[model samples]
Target: MTAMASVISKITAKNQVTVPKQVRQALGLKEHDQLRWIAKDDGSIEVKKANNNDFWGVVMEQQRRYGSINTPEPAWGPDVGGEVID
Candidate 1:
């Protein structure tokens, strides 16, 4: 196994930091790619590539912490709606 080199990046005044070239290549990150910052119980932070299908992870976490979200039924019915004509 090849040893990974440590790289450091400085956070700018706007709170943005550029991912190092080596790190970006290793993670297969491209322009406009999304990353998720996860805070661990050990006071450490982890950065991982964000997947579009991971939205359920957020919903499940919210449900576990604060119970499922309650959404109210629509106030208006189809009969009272301004139906669009095709």
Candidate 2:
């Protein structure tokens, strides 16, 4: 079996961490891509790319289930006018 190289990253004050370039390249990750973190029973965390279609499917299903409830109308009416400032 081939051995894998290890990379390290530090988390910022805002609790944001950057993925190492090697790991990103290995995973074929790109900008604006989503990741899911899984916490294992052994207290280890695993990260994987999130499936966009599954995410959107859940969103659409929730919308279909509760789309109309407690929705607010637009605050401004068509007759309301405002001057544009340069």
> lDDT per residue, candidate 2, 1-86, as tens digits?
23468778999999999998877776778999878788999999988877777977678767898884467877785776788899
Candidate models: Cα lDDT each: 0.83, 0.80
Model 1, C-alpha of 52: deviation from truth (Å): 1.8
Clashes of 2: 0
Looking at model 1, report the run of 10 residues with the lowest lDDT sum. Answer: 74-83
- The TM-score values for the models, in the order shown, are 0.64, 0.61
Model 1 error, position 74 (Å): 3.3
Clashing pairs in 2: none
- Candidate 1 vs. true structure, TM-score: 0.64
- Give candidate 2's error at residue 38 in angstroms: 0.2
